[model samples]
Structures are given as C-alpha cells and as structure tokens.
Target: MKTRSKIEDEYWGALERLKIGKTKVVDTKSTRFRITKDAVGREAGRGKGYVRYERYPLLCEAIADAEVARKKNGPVTPSSNAKIEQQKALKQKAISDYNQLKQAYDMLMTEYLNVVRRNFELETGLAEVKNVKIIRMPSVR
Candidate 1:
C-alpha cells in the first residue's frame, strides 16, 4: 500500500476543472473548459467538487506571498496556494507513472501473445527443426 510522505497533506484536497462546451482562447480548438453542471448543483459525489475560476490565481498568489513571508518566520504551515501547487505536482507525477506502467504492461502482453503463437506453431509441426532427431547403433556393426 502507498504511504504518505512527510510533506504530504493529511487530507488530500482537490480543485475541479470546468468542462467547456465551446472553443476558448486559452485551450486548444478541440478542448475547452467550464464549470460542470453537477458541480454547480453541489452534487455530493467523489471528485465532483468545483472551485470558482477566479480563485485559482488568487490562491497561487497567496502561496507565492507565503513563500516570501517564510523568510521572516522559521517554518509556517503552507498556504492554500502552496498546497494546491503540491497537489498538482503529485498529480502530474502520478500520470507519468501510470503511462510508464501501461506501456510496460502492453509490452509484456505482446510478448506473451507471441510466445503462445510460437508454442502453437511448434505443436502443429509448423516451426523450424520440424523432425525429431534419433540415434541408431548402425545395426550393431
């Protein structure tokens, strides 16, 4: 089981992205962002929570300001912004790890399939070294 790190927050908090319906200036033409409906309705579902569009930048700024303030104080608790940044970093790392694991799984599956095919071929006498070798004592000389 995965264990939390020293810096990891006891509670894993999250920010929700808006599901956009139309083309936006910031996103690619195919993709867009918007506040989801269920979230707007405050639906109590896992990972269904949402935050205002404006709050993100404000939180980021607060986190940055906290860093500046850190020099004055020895070690203060992280601001909301800093926690958000840490959450994002952890998410990105998780995604990277998932991709690598998926790639490895795919490769191993392919190799297994190939081995099965070769075994089938061998059993059906369709592979190389088709005939079994046998030794005779030359009619007892």
Candidate 2:
C-alpha cells in the first residue's frame, strides 16, 4: 500500500506539469504556441493545428492524488466498510466531473471550428469577386 501511494504521488506531480491554461511554444515554430489541457477552446496557427488534451488524463491524475492522500492519512482504514464506500463515492464524482469537462470542451471546439470555417469561406468568396469602380469626371474651369 505504501508503494502504491508513492507511485500515485509521483503520477500526480507529473500531471501538474500538464495542467490546463499552461502555455508552451512550439520548438520548431517560435510564433506557434500550444496551450496544454485547454478547458476553453482549441486554437491553431502558423504550421500547427488545433489539438486538445482529453479529460481522462486529468481525471486519472485527480484520482491518483486523492488515493495517495487517502492512503497516507485517511480518516479510516480499508478495514472499515464505510471507508471503502467513501472512496467509491469520491471516484464516482471524479468520473462525473471529467465527463462534464469533456462535454464542455467538445462544445467549445465545435463553436471554434464553425467560426473558422465561416471566416475562411467568406474570405475566399471576397477574393474571387472582381474589383469594380464608378468614376465621374469633374468639369474643367
């Protein structure tokens, strides 16, 4: 149990480096930036494309951290049925929260895609239209 707790602690620590809102620049393209674990919307630029981290990773990290804490100094040990039930409840809520976050990310991505697509179409259409002008000559004095 102690070993398991240590591993979970390490896993959680690693995940902290991958949290949402964290920004990193693309190694190859200085102008391109990647936002890790975005709960908002995916964005792309330069040579890069839109990408997002799935919520499952975050959920796993949260669960592992909680387990580590519970093992170290839980209110009760596994010998009690209530402690087991409490752990189970915590796991269920974590899963539910992950699902909700995933749904929100998906919705945001959909809106982002639609807006980009529409803008591209409009720009293309405008580009194809030929430029025209109407000019009237002023009378010479």
Candidate 3:
C-alpha cells in the first residue's frame, strides 16, 4: 500500500494543475459545509463546507481510503451507515490536515520564489526602481 504522504502528494499535485489552483474540504460540526474563495487560496469548512448530503470528489476519495485502511487493519466495525460516516469523518480530518499543510507549503514556496526573483531583479537593475534605491542586502526569506 502507498504511504499516506505519497497519496497526499499525488492529490496535491493534481490540485496544482487546476485553473482554480487550490481547493479544500472542511467538515464542520454543524450541518452543511461550503467552499469559500478569495484573492488568495481556497477555503472550505467541514460540515460547513457543502450543502446537505453533497458529495465532493476529494472528500469521497478520503473517505474511501479511510474505509479501506480500516478494513485492511482487521478489527472491522459494524457495517452501519452511521459508523461508516463517522469513520469517514475521522479519515477526512487527516486528509484535511495534509491539505492545509500542502497549501501552506505551496504558499511558502511561491513567496520564496517571488522574493528571490524580486531580489535578483533589484540587484541587476531590471525591476523598476523609480526614485527608490534598493540595497543588495542579505536575503531574509
């Protein structure tokens, strides 16, 4: 079986190819979870993310993986929808954590790249400096 990190990497890489770029699934304690977007990254809360009974692709995948892992581990829980749902939620929590980590990692890399690019441009007199003088200081990012 693939490691959880491997699965998460594949999922994040797939998400990176999107025109929208990023997405998240949040399962709130309350009914319905909705997706929120901004000029920055995407956001979704558990239970508060989608409408009632709405199914999301990533969320489904997480649930399925959780179920499989649970089954493979041997101590099988009762085959009830409620039990399944609870397990799925637990699994989804792990996925959500990894998703947030991936998003933060992406954001950090992007910021670092931009900082490097900006520093390079300033040092080489490529970026517009107008009246401002940029000193070649050590990189902080």
Candidate 4:
C-alpha cells in the first residue's frame, strides 16, 4: 500500500499540473469531473467515476479555480464577474484554513508518537531505542 505521504504527493502534483494548464478538467453527465492530461487526454488520478472532493480536496479546488478562470476569460456580465471573484476569494480562504488545520494535526500526531515512545522506554527499561512501531486496530462503529 502507498504511504500517506506518497498519496498526498500525487494529489499535490496533479493539482499543480491542473493549475498550470498541463491538465484539464472534464465534466461528466452527472455532477462529476475528471482531471486529464493535456497532451494525450489521459486520466491523471485513480478511479473511473467522477473525482470526489472528500478524496482529493486540492484537486477539486484546482478544478474549481480553472472553471472560474475560464468563465472570467470569456464574456461575462458585471454581476456574475463580481460573484466569480467572491467565490475565488472564498475558495482561497478555505484552502488556507484547511492547510492550517492539517499542519496542527500533523504536529499533534508527532507529539503523540513521542509520548508513546517515552512511555514504552520507561516501561521496558530500554535506553535510547531509535525505532518504535505502532499498530493501529480498527475501531468499532
């Protein structure tokens, strides 16, 4: 299985490609969309169905930004233009907030791991153990 870091790297890379016009977002009949490469129109990410925001939030943000840019570049009324600008700002803020929360979560996880390691050392009387493995069990719903 791919590590979380690897998955996040792939998502961020795809989002960057989409932002720079290296990839394009294609909309389906349902309210779903796919990100495809510009060169050969190949799908960038995994899965056959429409991209889900819950799975790839950054990619979805990129797609929304691309759509807003497309609309702004084309013929648009003043009121609609203002709305688009508002939406863009809101999206940026949301991304910023999400990033901050993610960072906090990462820090908390690191602290938790350190505490666990210390506890293990104190209980087992092991000195300076460099490796600690954690096995997580599935939680009951």
Worst 10 contiguous positions by lDDT, candidate 2: 39-48
* Positional deviation of residue 61's Cα in model 4 after best superposition, in angstroms: 50
lDDT of 3: 0.49
Query: Candidate 3: which stretches are off by over 4 Å?
Result: 1-84, 126-141
Candidate 2 lDDT at 94 equals: 100
Query: Per-residue alpha-carbon lDDT of model 3 for 1-141, expressed as tens digits?
Result: 633454344443433322233434323222332222211113322233232224334544544554455347544446799788988999999999999999999999999999999978767684365666665669898
For model 3, give the 10-residue run with minimal summed lDDT. Answer: 33-42
Question: Can you write out model 1's per-residue Cα lDDT over 109-140, one digit (the tens) per residue?
Answer: 99999999997786566434546643335776
Query: Across residues 21-106, which tens digit of lDDT does each residue of candidate 4 receive?
Result: 45544333223333332211233455444456676565566667766775566444459889999999999999999999999999
What value of lDDT does candidate 4 attain over all alpha carbons? 0.59
The candidate scoring highest on lDDT is: 4
Candidate 4: Cα lDDT at 108: 100
How much is the lDDT of residue 31 in candidate 4? 32
